[model samples]
Structures are given as C-alpha cells and as structure tokens.
Target: MATLIGREIHLASRPTGWPTPDNFSLVEAPVPAVGPGQVLVRNRFLSVDPYMRGRMNDVKSYVPPFRVGEAMEGGAVGEVVDPGDSALSRGDLVLHQSGWREYAVLDAERTSALPPVPGLSPSVYLGALGMPGLTAYVGLLDIAGMQPGDQVFVSSAAGAVGSLAGQIARLRGASRVIGSAGTAAKVAYVRDLGFDAAFDYHDGPVSQALAQAAPDGIDVYFDNVGGDHLAAAISRLRRNGRAALCGAIAGYNAETPVPGPANLALVITKRLTLRGFIITDHRDRMPDFIKEMSGWLREGNVRFNETYVDGIEHAVDAFLGVFQGTNTGKMIVRLD
Candidate 1:
C-alpha cells in the first residue's frame, strides 16, 4: 500500500583502465508502480561478470556501453511483487536483465518465469542455469563443434563460463579436459570438478603449462582469457582444431591496444576454426541447453561455485573482484 524505496548501483564514470569504486555510485530511489502490461520485481540477486567491464567503456562492441548516471544492468532473479499482466502473478519467481537495483518495473514480456528446479537453489539461474550456462553450451557445442573424445582446453576454467564449459566437454565424452586458472587453489578446484588436468597460469607461461598438460595437442580450445592464452592455444592446437572465441578478459581493461596472437598463423597452418559469438544471438538454443544442463545439475554430473557479496552497496567491489581473480567462480551480489 506504501511506496517502496529501492537502492541501485549506477555507472558514475567510465574507467580509463581498471575500474575503481569511484566509477560507481549507490543511490536510493522510489520503486515505480506496475503499470498496465508491466510487472514490479524485487531483485534478490545480481550478477557481476567480466563482460560488464567492456560495457563500461565508451566503445562500439557487441553490446552497447553503459550510460553514465544510469543503473548498471545484468542478469537478475527476483520475485514479482506487483503483477499487471494476466500471465504473471505476485510471488512468482522470474529472471530478467534489470539487475544492479533492488527493485525493477518493466514490461511483463521482459521477465521470464522461473520454474522450480527440485533440489537446486533459484539463484542458480543467475549462474550455472542462466547466461553463463547458456554461453558455455552454445560456445562449445555449436561454435567449436565439439565431438566425442576430443581433447578440450578451457582458459579461466575456474570461473563461471569456463568451469561449466570444461564439465560439459567431459560429460559430452571428451577424452581429456584441461583447464587453466590464475591460482593454485582454482586449479585444484577445477581438477576436483572433473578436469583431467588443471594448471595455474601464474606458475609459468600458458604455452608451456598447456603443452605439459596436453602433450599431444588439443582438439578444442574454449578461450576466455585472450592475449597470451590465445597464442598458447593456437600453438598447441592439432590440425583442424576448433576454438570458441569467448571473452578476452585479459584485454578488457587495456588502455592501449593489445597485440594479436603471433601464432595466429597456426590457424591457417593447422587449418583451425576460430569463431566468436554473442550468446543472445543463439536464443533458440536455450530450450535445449536448459534441458541438458538441468539434467546435469540434477544428477550431479555438473557442479558450480558462486561467491556472494552481501548488499547493493558492495556491488562495485564484486564487479572489480572478477578482474582481480578474487572469485574462484561466479561473483554475485545478494541484494536482499
């Protein structure tokens, strides 16, 4: 019956290099009432991912840059508080792209109702069962053309997308799954998660580490961190190897142009296929991905981790933590 006051994190300024806390501001505002054909949602969780760093920059990319003084947006799961559409009811759980805020008012069509997954948390939709999951699914199977018994290598393997990508490869019958991470603990974690081999990139050069991990050469490379990792994968790929060009978090904060992989010539010499994709472009794959991934999660064939930072006020730190390698898995903010 009373107006709801909500808090949100806004992009205060674009960062020149690495983002700082000053780049974001948390402010309180009134939560708008649900209008005809609209729904009001109180967000319970917000996602902070490496891709967001690119969105903060004023550059032309697959997605538009975030506008200064506007609330940052990403994946979020919430409960509907006010429903103006006949299809949705109050108390229904939904997923939408109106995060970085405690409450959102949007057209009902923008929100997708989340069906209850027995024995799984609803917040999982913001991680393994959500965009990150879909990214891994489409990137590996469709883009990279993964085949059974292929040797697959994934960079940033302990993180959200890479973690799932490796497991998916294994579950789909990869003969060997190798992962590269930033720290020893992360390497161990991925190994326990079923990677046949895991290594800390900080311990040595990526090329050398990868070569040692996969002596015969890899058939599929799921690249998350570009730069040197790309070069390493290129050098070690067997003939006709395929690479799913995912995120390049290594260059996300670069003020200067980063160099292309010198060994890219291998793409031609080895006849490799390197392709980049935007997950939204493959929306038609969601039903299949959900069906398969849900089964995996239910059967414990796939596992995921999430680092939760409490409160909307700390959303900036959560976002920055992704680049700092502080989170071993998906970094999320608990806004409730």
Candidate 2:
C-alpha cells in the first residue's frame, strides 16, 4: 500500500457574518500507513456547505463549532488507493468525511463503500446522490410531511439543497413549486429546473414576492435563506402550514444581529409550524432516499446540478465562494 500525504484546511479566524479569505488556512501533513480496520483515501471530491458557516462561529449550534487551527470538517468522496481493511478494496470509490484535503486516512468504520454508477460522474456522489439529495428528501417528506396538491416554497431555490427540494416537491405531486433566488441568473436557473415559478429575492421584499407567487398561501416552506424569507413565508402560509428550516445562508457572514420583523407574530396567529433540522439527524432514511433518487435519475424524472472546482488546492476558494452566492448548485472540490 502506498502512503499518501494529506493536506487539510484549518480555520484561521471567525467571521462576523459571511466568511472571507481571512477565515481559512491550508496545511499539508504526512499520511500514515494504514492499520487493520483503516483505509487510506486519495480524496477526489469534497463538499462546501452554507451550514459550515454557522459551525465556524465559536457559538452554540446543533453541531460543534469549528476550532481554530484545526481541520474544517466536511464530506469527501475518493477512491481507495491503498486498502488496509477487509471491508474496502483498492480502487473502490467511497464516501467519507474528511476536510479540504488532497488525501485522508480514515477508520474503516467511519466510511462507506459507494455503489458504482454507470455513465455518471463520481463527483456527484458528494452532491445530488449525496448529502444535499438526502437533505432535500428528509426535510420535505419526513420533516415537512409533504402531500399531493400541497403548495411548496423553497428559499435559495438555486442552491444545493433548495434546488433539489423544489424538484422533489414536484415529483411528489406538489400543486405548485415556488422558489426564491438571489440573482436573476439564479432565478432563471430555478425556473429552468422546472419549478412552477421563481422570484428574485433581490427584487425588493421577499415576502411580498412570495405572496405574489402563491396568492392562495403556501402549504409548506422549505426554508434555506432564513430571516426575511422565513418571515414572508410565515405571513402567507395556510393555517397549520408546515415549514422545514434548512439553512440560513443569508446571514452567515454578518457581524451584526439579524433582526426579525413584525410578521413573526403570524407564526402564532396562523398556527404555522416552523422547524429547523439538520440532515445528519435523518441518516436513518438514507438507504430509502438512495433507492428512490437512483430510480428517479435512471427514469429521468429528477435531475441534480453541481458546480465543481478542480483540485484540493482550490478548495478553500471554492468553499468561500458558496457564501458569495457564486455557485449555481452544490459546490464541490475535485482532487483528481
């Protein structure tokens, strides 16, 4: 087995809201020889998520905060270049959690062997068929309890999780799918994704825009950008409407407090249910999601998109780009 050197990303400084280059550092380290029940991976793909922004702050969250000078953790997909465990073999593609790095050595128990996909890219295993896909599925179906003819709204509709949520809602018989995006390009991008309608949140009031799209009121809101988008959805939700709070990409880098508006009272008055959830909590449903998403992919019923940056060296910039709304879909880093 060959010894592969690993390069890891470290948290340099904490950002007030959205992150900048000052927030991250890159370090290279020696890769150790694997022992029994261990696998050395030459990572090919890694994920950059908005949720990581919350984790970067030294504050309380559902997940632990990132420690300074330590590796910033994220999901990665790579081939088993050297195998030391019986569960994995050389050249097998696997999904594991490492950081922004060229290679990683992980305990076999912490990794899973990914199934082969014919005529599909391995990088997507970190995207549509990966975390974002499962996040969309569980948040909408399991958490939101979606049903046919339900009107669904997704904030950051052009983003990694939001984009998929809208399509999944459509596939599951949503009467209408409305999305909110940051840019005109992203707005059009969501519409092209086959959403019933999409609006640019930059166009004045987000809630007012949502009201225009779903005049009858929304049955469910798959929230990605929190704050105003959330308040707006609450203002227009049907009685006892359900909301799946995913991420708050809107205020990730802000140094100031994000203020809530007058519409929040609607949550109590309308009896609207707004709940925040992390994808990790729903891992138990992964096998079923994989089975269903795979079928939809093969049948051409559902599609997923990704923005890739080549090489782990570019991972830091690629990761920071997501906060600037530079990516059109899920942002990933490719090592090969």
Candidate 3:
C-alpha cells in the first residue's frame, strides 16, 4: 500500500476563557506505523463534547489536560485497515479514544470492537450509544436514585447529555419531566422528545420557569447547567428530592469562579441529596446501559439526533459550536 497521510487538530494555545479559532490548528502528518500487537484505523467520526472545554486548560482534574501541541483526543469510531499481529481483522468496526485525527495507530486492546446495530450508524456509539448515553444512564438511575413516578427536571435539556437524561427519566416512568433550554426552538425540541414541560431560560428567571413547569415541585433534578439553574432547582425540589449533578457547562468557560447557587441553604431545609459524578468512575454500568438503551432505541422508546460537520478540518468549528448551543443533540465531525 502507498504511504498514508493524515490531518489532526492540535491545541495551538490554551484559551483564558472561551476558545477561539486561533486556539486550534489543523496540521498534516504521516499516519504512524502499526507496531506488533497494534492496529491502524481510519476514523469515520469524531465527537466534540462540553467536557472537552475543561480539558483545554492546564489545570489538574479527573482527566489530564490536553497538551498544547498534541492531537486532542475524545471519542471516535473507525474501521481497522491493518491489524498487525492482533486479533482484529481489516475492515472491523471499532470504537477508540483517538479522535481529532483522521487516522490512529494503537494497541489492539485500546480499541473495542463495535457490534453492528441494524438501522443505526456506528457514529451513534459516540453519542446516544456511547459515553454521553452512559453518562445519562448512570447519573439518573444511580446517582439520582430516580424512582418510578418521580417528577424530574433537567437543565440544558437539548444538549447531548441532558437530552438523553430527560428522555431516560421519561422512559423510566417519571410521572412528569421538565426541561430548560437556551432557545425557543430547543425548548420545542425538548418537548417533542417527550418532556412534559420545557422552557427557554432566556424567557424569564429560571426560578420562575421551574416553579411554573413543575407546580407541584420536582422529585429529581438532573443538573447539566449549574449557576442559576441549580439555584432554581434547589428552590423547587420537594423535600427529600434527589439531584444528580452532571456537567456544569454554564461555567466551563468562566474566567473566574462561578458562584454557587444562592439557595444551597435550601438543600438542608428541603433534605435534598445532591451528588456530582464523573461518568468514567461508573464504567461497570456500561453493559447494563448498552443493553437497555439499545432496546429503547430499537423499540423507538428513545431517539437521538446528531448535527454533523463534515471534514476533520472543521473539527474546531464543531467544538466551538457546543458552547454556542448550535446543536440540538450530539455534535459530530465526519472525517470520511
């Protein structure tokens, strides 16, 4: 075979606040050779997620920060082109963590063979069927300890994770599910996803919106947006309410510390249980999540949407779009 070349996006500079186009650079390079026990893959899709925003900084966190000059990595799905002394065969579909690049060479063990799901693209593994889906599953079912007939509220309801969180609550027998989004269209989209109520946060105070949406108060809160939304949820949480604290995208790009919700005192008075979680810590649940979520997708009980931006050259644009709320569901970059 002729020599293969690939392009990857590198973090050119760490941004102080919100990242700009200048923070990333697309560079051409030769695809690395596959060593023994390794495999070469041609990535088909790349995921751009809200959590990645935090990785751009040099601060210490659950995961290491992305190096300034290295290819930024996330979720990706690809096909094996060369299986060098590995069990994987050519053309095998797999999921890995070498995104932001067109090709990857890694130990075979680093790639998980992807089973074909009829009527769904392999890219679904990066969104509704992948990390985001598992995040929702663990956060709602385990962290929040959601029970049947619980009235639920999810912030940033139209986001990749939040969207799934809301739908999962409804499918799991929540008596009522309310959501908050950033736009009128997103609010409507959330409602279409079967949320009992969804409101655009820009319409009025988030507190008032929550009060109106769940007049009887909520039994559970799936927190994707913090700040004001957290405060509002605290006030509206019924006594003994449970909250699964997921991503706080509302402050991911803040230059200064984002203030804590003013109604935190209410947590004590209302006997609320608020627990934050990192999805990676709950990988034990992946098997159960995949089995249940796959059935839901196949039965049409749950649905997912993707906004695609073609080409690796535009991966940065896709990443930036997440903060702009430009995607109704998962935002993906197509490299094929």
TM-scores for every predicted model? 0.97, 0.94, 0.98
Candidate 1: list runs displaced more than 4 Å: none
- Clashing residue pairs in all predictions, respectively, total 0, 6, 0
Rank the candidate models, highest TM-score first.
Answer: 3, 1, 2
Task: Report the lDDT tens digits of candidate 1 across residue range 136-165.
Answer: 999999999999989999999999999999
Whole-model lDDT, candidate 2? 0.85
> Candidate 3, which ten residues in sequence have the lowest lDDT sum?
105-114
RMSD of each: 1.2, 1.8, 1.0
Minimal lDDT window, size 10, model 1: 105-114
Better of 2 and 3 by TM-score: 3
> Which residue pairs come into collision in candidate 3?
none
The global C-alpha lDDT for each of the candidates, from Candidate 1 onward, is: 0.92, 0.85, 0.92
Tens-digit lDDT track for model 3 on 74-127? Answer: 989989988888888899999989999999997887666789989988899998
Model 1's alpha-carbon lDDT is 0.92
- Residues 234-314, model 2: lDDT tens digits: 888999899998887766777887886578778888888878898888889999999998988888787777898887778
